[model samples]
Target: MNLEILTPERKLYNGEVYGVQLPGVDGLFEVLEKHAPMVSALKAGKLKVLKDKSMSDTTSYAIQGGFVEVFHNKVTVLVEGAVPAEAGR
Candidate 1:
């Protein structure tokens, strides 16, 4: 699936990803390739980017409360603000 993370100031990420773990308002949820379409509110927490199923490379962001939309094999995260998570590797 393709993923993009955006804030008012700039785009944080734009690329293909295997899946993504998001901080939904109620809890955590994940979006994978060809996942069903939906929209959800988000909370301030860590967002994990799964670059591939092999799990060799990944990214994480510290995101403030935001919203997420999943549709057509794409996941878009709109955040109040965000920064690269210190724990990313």
Candidate 2:
């Protein structure tokens, strides 16, 4: 799956991935390749993305509330606010 994380300022991430774990408004959900089309509201929490190979670990990001759209084998996440996980250090 191709994933993108965007904000009003700029595009945070855009690339291929195995899966993603999103903090949905209601709860958390995982999106894998070939996932059914849908839209979701995000919560203020962590966004975990599994990139690279099958056994690869996920990368975590911190973000505020936002919306997510899935289509055409791609997932786009738009956030009210976001910062790289490392930035929290």
Candidate 3:
């Protein structure tokens, strides 16, 4: 799936990804290739990106809060703020 993570100041990430784990307001949820269309609220937490099906290649970010929309094999995340997990640490 194609994923884009955006903030008010900049675009954090934009690329193809195997899947993504989001910090939904209710808890955590994942979106994968060909996922059904939907939107959800997000909370402050880690957002993980699965670079491949193996799950070995991955990246993570700490997001403040946001909203996510999935449609047509694309995932768009609009957040208030975010930092790479490693950078945050």
State each model's CA lDDT, in order.
Answer: 0.93, 0.89, 0.96
Q: Name the candidate, 1 or 2, with the larger lDDT value.
A: 1
Which of 2 and 3 is ahead in lDDT?
3
lDDT of 2 at 25: 88
Per-residue lDDT of 6-78 in model 3, one digit per residue for the tens?
Answer: 9999999999999999999999999999999999999999999999999888999999998999999999999
C-alpha lDDT of residue 15 in model 3: 100
TM-score computed on alpha carbons, candidate 3: 0.96
- Top candidate, metric TM-score: 3
Model 1 alpha-carbon miss at residue 10, Å:
0.4
lDDT of residue 39 for candidate 3: 95
Please write out the lDDT profile of model 1 over residues 17-37, one tens digit for every residue: 999999998999989999999
Comparison by TM-score, 2 against 3, better one: 3
Q: Identify the runs in model 1 with alpha carbons over 4 angstroms from their true place.
A: none
Q: What is the TM-score of each candidate against the true structure?
A: 0.95, 0.89, 0.96
Candidate with maximal lDDT: 3
